[model samples]
Target: MKVLVTGGSGFIATWIRHQLLARGHTVLVMDHQDRRGGLLDGEEFFLGDVRDATAVTEAAAHADGIIHLAAVLGTQETISNPRPSAETNIIGSLNVFEAATQYRIPTVYAGVGNHFMRLQGTGCYTITKSAAEDLARMYNAYRDGGQVAIVRPVNAYGPGQSVAAPYGTSKVRKVMPAFTCRALTGTPIEVYGDGTQVSDCVYVEDVARVFVAALEHTACHGAPAQPIEVGPATSCTVLDIARLVADTAAEMTGRAPVDITHLPMRPGEVPNAVVRADTSTLDVLGADHGADSFVPLADGIRNTVRYYAEHWLPGYQLQAA
Candidate 1:
């Protein structure tokens, strides 16, 4: 099988490529050449942005499927930089859908997530992404060709994630990077707002698997997708997550216990922005791949912490060790 992944250098998209390649599938990645990182030495790459329709069209040619992971993420970042987000998430999505239509690809998978409903302060980002999700639905119905699946992933966490500004940056953006960075650095692990807002953190690997599963599901094949929510079955609060990270870090580093501080919640943020996954749709894809098949949450955090310790944070001085 041949596939094209947009924004293939992104944290999760890169993993999507990795998983597809592992399964013996040929993968073509289209992303901005100027972006800091490219795929590991051997991956096929097309240096282009999603908004460049001509470039996207050229890159997507002859591909059996298209995994659309290209978009502007982060609410605060979107508010700070709305133009690029709109250009990428909205206009860029249109280009992908149109390109898929032109190529008549059998399957087009677009990434969506709870951010549509969960993220508030970053209205610029959420609104645009939600609009992109609408485009996926419209393309499925109006375009009248190819299968369009919107995989709505929630709080995906794992290694190889970027920690730079405007990427994982957010006031209420207590997602994967926030939790992992805090745990790794022995920071206070501040839980923004009241610290009671609930969310489910999905392992990035599992999220990639969901994309592949949705792609392979016969029910989803040539059928209209109803925004499938992919993540762990249970949702935990921010405070719960901070506590878990503290405990996990303590175990991993044999460090003294640290306190979790509560800060003012960002405006427009939801208190319990939880999503109920319609497992029936996912079940059609395959057997019960049990919710936590990706990696245990604690184990995932430990691994992420290790990644930071050995790679990104290696040169930093130890905290009075």
Candidate 2:
């Protein structure tokens, strides 16, 4: 099978590309930016944007399947600039769906877990993603064309994730990287609103596997479009995640445990009391691997801390020098 992955340079998409290759599928990557490196022999790349239907259609001409992963994420960015978010997340998704419908090709839509359970106060990121998910369902139902599977992934974390702004212009503070960096530098790990909000953090490799499973699942074909939840079975509080990173970093760097300091929650950020992926749909699709096979949080944190310590921290030190 030949699979076309949008946003192939992204954190999760990179792993997904490797998984596709491992499965003996021809991989075609379509992205606006070329952050790809170390491509396997015979793999192909298409420089394009998902917002342009013509570009997507041309890029996906030889695809047996499409995995739509391109979108502008992050609550702060979306809230601050809703136009670009809507353009990329909604309009861009529409382009993919249209192309899939045109080519009669199966597509897997990358969705967010927050959109399914809670919508209010989650900001434009959730809003646009929810709209895109709905658009995918609409195309799946009425088009009478190809299959569309929606996978709502939980908070995915791992190595090679973008920890700061590209080119080091500013900070893009994600949970794991932020905590790990602070802990390594002997700085306080900032926790917002008492750190009681729970989130299901799934490893990137696990997520990539689930995506491939969802893309090829037979149960999704010819059925009413429904979302398959993919993530760890358990949920952990924000404070718990912070402390785990702190402990892991301390062990690796021989530094004292960092303090978890409470801070005011950001605007438009909803504190999720509980967040867990419902893998029942995955079970029906025979893709229930993520239910029991997710990496343990502590081990995942250790690996992530090591990645930052080796890859990101050294660069920062050299630049400072």
* Candidate 1: segments with Cα more than 4 A from true spot: 34-42, 115-122, 164-174, 218-220, 288-292, 318-321
TM-score, candidate 2, is 0.94
Candidate 1 per-residue lDDT over residues 211-246, each given as its tens digit: 866665523366434766676756677777788877
lDDT of 2 at 136: 84
lDDT of 1 at 196: 72
Off by over 4 Å in 2: 36-38, 165-171, 218-225
Model 1 scores a C-alpha lDDT of 0.70
Per-residue alpha-carbon lDDT of model 2 for 1-321, expressed as tens digits?
789999888889989999988878889988898745756665788889888888998987889899899988887777777898899999999988888888888888899977844356577888998898889878876887857788888888999887754324433457777777788878898888888888778888988988887777723454335688877767788888998998888898887898889988887666655767786766755634747777888888888999989998888768767
Clashes of 2: 0
TM-score of 1: 0.88
